[model samples]
Target: MTSRNRSTRVSILSALIGATLAVPAAFAGQVDTAGIQSDGSYARLVVKYRDSARLRTAAADRVAETIAGAAARAGIAGGVARGGAALPLSASRLRATASQADVVRLSRALDANQTQALLRQIAADPSVEFVQVDRRLTHTRLPDVRPMLVPNDNYYQQYQWHLHDAIGGIGAESAWETSTGEGVVVAVLDTGITAHPDMDANMLEGYDFITDAFVSRRDSDERVPGAADLGDWNPVANECYAGSPVTDSSWHGTHTAGTVAELTDNATGMAGVAHDAKVLPVRVLGRCGGYTSDIADAIVWASGGEVDGVPTNASPAEVINMSLGGGGACDTLTQDAINGAVSRGTVVVVAAGNQGQDAANHSPASCANVINVGATGITGIKAYYSNYGNLVDLSAPGGGVTDGNPDGYVWQAINSGATVPEDPTYGGMAGTSMAAPHVAGIVALIQSAVEVPKTPAEIEAILKESARAFASAPSQPMGAGIVDAPAALALALDGGGEEPCEPGEPGCEEEPPIDSTPITSGQVVTGLSGVAGTEGLYRIEVPAGMRNLNVLTYGGTGDVSVYVSRGSEPGADEHDWASTRPGTNETVRVANPEAGVYYVKVVGESLYARVNLQARYN
Candidate 1:
């Protein structure tokens, strides 16, 4: 594929306007306060009202009255205040969330504590469904100095080890021979993008979803066309937050976009994972960080959903990469967006955050129906700053700059600008933010490699089933393993299983029966046996709200280990929970297991027979 000039392509973005957004199903409970700060700093609230004729067509005044009513009922007092000045808590309808909930917003920024209290009040109202603070999420990159070798790309051999290095790479070089992600579109939702000659040819028209004029750095609050990198440089002290570090523009989106779809074999820059694919650069982040509301809209629009004011996407993305996140569980707004995208067949991949904590506490990363990615160093160990835990679905090379390996950073195209757009150059950055695009690009490769596009579920299964085991044991659970592009593509192309051999092919034989046997709760299976280095895979469908899930193996002669994981197959070393006793008897229990398909792998440490396995949850 040849590169094309941007000036010659028709723009796909148009004027952004306010409209009702589609929301997800009713999430009953106290509003999500996971990311809400209690520091008393100023912030706004995202409120979703029960669908009523009044709310669907309510005016701004009516919405305000609803807020007042909720506050009064909660026994709160006093008007909202900002900067020590009394301000009217105005309301504005954004759009219906995917749940069909009427999403409204409080315009006046109130004290964080006050806002949280108000959110609870709003959530308690009979007419209100859910409410939460529209927390800001930043790009998850850790700054580092940045080359690579491969496919005649100048930097591939020197700097892009994350693509082909057997120890840590995604096997992209070999996968490229099978698929270059041709005809696939990957939407990059981040700080927009910069003009880089190396990636310019593969760029698609994208939109800016930022609504705040202050954050968008525009004169008007209205969303505009074109998702250009406007430089989110924090020029003033504490502009983002009190004592927030002053830093230059990250050009984060450009780097990620380059990783996803930069032109390959151009003989000038580093190779991209899916160079034949196109990038739809949706700008959601800006100065300081972007709001959850804006990012959610980007997710919806990029996946070909309707967003009020923005034109329908000319080229809906098959994969969406969000290398941004912040503290919090999955918020309703973001989850609804992701749910819609997944239902539309878009594979959503997100960063596991750079907080070095459980990703379960992070929004988007913790969101269901999305592939959560953690970062790995050059040695294929979990990055020290990458978030971990059960929610992380997989790990990828995100570089280990802070781990003292300067050359281990993921390198890609970036701008030389400090405050605005500058000359295009290459650099390295570390974090799970860098890890996500690698997976996203692999998704594109798999999507393009097969004759039929795999569903989001199928894609996820292929990635996990084909992933290479981590080179070393991680300090924390880093997911199934590192994504292997060639393996994944091959799996997809082989009809999601072993490719059928030709009748006359040499060494061809009948395939063995699949080992995936369904096990129900409180059921015990007898006569389970396996030889050393062999394993039996079983699954249990744990319905929602299952507590005390217990899987026990006993009455067996051999030494067997039990490995359990949710939603995907588990390996001896990669599972959510494990029990390896000296004998065949082993037990793994969970206090409150999330409702999903739990996979159990019974591996034989030594050869023996006559085993009984029981999985029961109350």
Candidate 2:
């Protein structure tokens, strides 16, 4: 399709917000959590009331009373909105119409040790719906210092090996055949982007959440218009902070933005992972990093929430790309905001911290419900500096600058100058930061597929399930393997699996005598037994390292049999595991099974039995 034709289709679909936000029903009541400081105190607490509508409709007196009641219930003598005190409305510079009167500020008199108790008391009160600790986060990328060859697009292909390299790349070419992320909006929250020839047209007006004038390096105290990169250089004469050394601006956000949706086929610069997708360039980082409060507000606003003190975002993102982070754990503040974004249908892709240690120690990455990405080098091994352990959900090419070759670095658009008159140029950087945008770009492609919008959980499942297995496992496990954009897209569009099979001994009239549905872990399939003595058959493709496979049947008055078989066909010797007995629930769990397709049989012992079968693999 031509550009003009595709543009119209995108406009029509733009209204389909959070088209893919599928999360487990069990997590609904829990507050999104993140890292905790050792000081026994999270800098802040995000208190959400039982009703969101109250923020907009409640009168001043009522709002004030609600705040007072919550604080008093928590036994806070000072550290909160006191009764009859002038209300301190939670506000952000960008959200002009937002009402933060619902958020009660903790009093300064309270010590960090007193927080947990007060928080518990506040939480026990029925008035509070959700609360999270305000944790700190820093940019996940570190420092480094790319052109090369490719097919068609005469741009910076040689330097962008991470985009097409067979060793560790996502195979951008094949994935582009299906989608260019035409209608998707990917929000980048970082130091911000500068004017770059390759990415200007793809940019959206974003807010500056860095409220400190010194850190913002701007004349104003609050947020302003376009998301421009005002050099982050901390000169020697004016150190960014006490004991901080002067350094050059990284233009970190600009580089990540370039990787996600920089203009492609235009042939002026490198092709982006999702060329046609729009970028919502959010500025959340600045000199000496940024505050967690500012970052949290950006996450809320980016997901289309009414963040107090800031205007509602005109273009809410379907995928939020956060390449920046600090260490600790998943802080409650960041986690809660992330949950809000995910709840609104946004797929958040975060960089595993650059620290070469267990990723479980990192925030957001370890937080619930987000896709945490690790970095791999051109050799397809975990990058030396990339975080490892179970927390990493997947891995991507973040470049290996020290692999004895400059070619290993992922290259993209940036400004060479340290501070002002932006000079559009290209360079290479190596970190988990570079890996995240790759996933974000692919997420845009997945979201823009003709198939239905996928929830964050579904999207993660697809990306992990479809990843190309590494030739050999890394020293540390890095998810299922490197992300395979083409494979992930194909699986995503397939819509989980084929329809379920009808009840019968053979289940079908075919020669195989079985019709199976494609199944991923955590998927539940329901079917009717039709009549007594008949059975419902299903097939599951269990990936490698899947240590547990459990099949359970629930509901129906009649007796039902549940069994797991080793092959595609259910036979006499095929039963590797079985749970037989009459009752409402029957379960069979296999601790170890050969990596291959497994068949599940649900037998009905009575007339018209309604059975719900679910398969779980981990």
Candidate 3:
């Protein structure tokens, strides 16, 4: 394989796959509707009231009335001024959010400026906790192109190269021999999953949480049971926003769920990564895009949390696959929901976006406690449209047919209808949306393979340690490496196999014992150097009451990695936090670290010189 010129390869690719592939660098003849404006364009607000006995015990109607009064006092009653014209501000009532009763969703006709002003005024009320715009999120899928040369024979062994290909696959076939993800549940939160013979059996009863009538295309603004695809087809261009194009309903949830748990060994169509795992389809996205508030509620509900009006999830998922994303920092509502899910032992996996830019600019992808997955092609190189940055945790096969690799798209089950449900068939699609589920399925495999379930942090550490090296150095940083399913399963079964010395254990020297170097807080060491096979160790004493522990290595040159652990020796495979970006720049942050002696290890992936290392806490 040869490398292509990155500067010249930014163009729309429309061969092999009939649909025009939207490359991140360019979109020709069509607008990439997936790109959303992060600021001042929203028409809704999410307000969370402060937690108090009075607020908690108040009636839902009473709470709604209080929120309404606050909004009215904020000068949000009349028409909103935009572009020298006043837009009608509908008399909207506040509705309690399903996930948390204290939180409410307010919809009205307002431009960006009025929304911001209203939010500020509402937040000033003593009864209010926090308020922000209800941002919109869209599925991360690029177009799926039906391959012309698909054989009439078994597609699993022939076309599903991403599952078993040694260079680009997740080694799902090998891992299947040990674990088929039995008894594990995974939640796919995208456009609702449709009825497909290939994946129907594995799907549990789901709910449609889209509350807006226009977005849901339903009779009224109400969240109903049963997660079904209502066809997010846009008949008219610009219906979603200014310049948004007309498009067909992408059965996105069904495609992603098929990749996660579609039936295998049935002598049938395709093989899913975790063929035996149960899928809990959660519908949050719809026409245009779903509101961030709705997606947040689904996250909490799918993880066995209590939603105000929804039934309890009898079978809460052990893992969540969010193949959807949008721009901006993670909102407070979404973060709170994710925090709740992680605390309940659910591992969240999200797409690194298809922007071909820094992933830090995207939400959920940049959110904490999530496994941010980037896309890799059959050649084991980063996909051209995949978002790349230090925040990306790993890479998986999301296909790259448009990047001069004509046959690298991921094949899976899809609907045949252009605007609604039809016959079940197979097709090839590409994007970080596809990449995320591969990792999510692998996580299920790991969970099933182990005798005991691991914590989110432990599972993450295992994945990073077991990832496969890229075929060659990538042009940009794409996480630790491509995810290796077999390696990750083996690591988990072996209990992560690290024998770090714990604090208060005998033979654990308090001082720097000859082999290690001692460093102090707020200290910076420069001119550090190492070879490919060499290792550098440093230790620091963290006191109590410090809010954060930060160990960073940057400046100078060469490829270096930083690993940190509390009260134990850190290494490549044994550390609480690991930062292994491509270059010398690396950072490991530990929140509310315990008071103890922490170990830091710096290892070179290649020959290195003149590196700087620092340790600080506050």
151: Cα error in model 2, Å: 19
Q: Is candidate 2 or 3 superior in lDDT?
A: 3
Provide the RMSD of all predictions against the true structure, rounded to 1 decimal: 9.4, 12.0, 10.4
lDDT of 2 by residue, 151-183 (tens): 234545566778888877899999999999999
- Which of 1 and 2 is the better model by lDDT? 1
After superposition, candidate 2 runs with Cα above 4 Å error: 1-36, 39-133, 144-155, 236-244, 497-618
Off by over 4 Å in 1: 1-30, 40-42, 52-57, 72-108, 143-153, 401-406, 497-580, 588-618
What TM-score would each prediction reach against the true structure? 0.80, 0.67, 0.77
Ranking by lDDT: 1, 3, 2
lDDT of each: 0.78, 0.70, 0.77
Better of 1 and 2 by TM-score: 1
Q: Candidate 3 on 1-618: residue-level lDDT in tens?
A: 112111100011111101132232232111111123523355566655555445455545545565466557656664547765654333243466654434444545466655655555555555555666677889998854444333245588777879998998899888998899999999999998888777889999988888888888889878888888888889999898777898988888888999999999887788899999999999899899898888999999999888877889999999999999888666667777888999999999999999899887787887788888999988888888999976787899999733433357888888777888887787778899999999999999989888879878777778877888788777887877889998999988988724345657897654444357899988999998878867888989887667777889988888998877765677776666788888899888765565667888889988888999999999
Better of 2 and 3 by TM-score: 3
Top model number, TM-score:
1
Candidate 3: where are CA atoms >4 Å away?
1-40, 51-77, 80-91, 98-107, 144-152, 401-406, 497-618
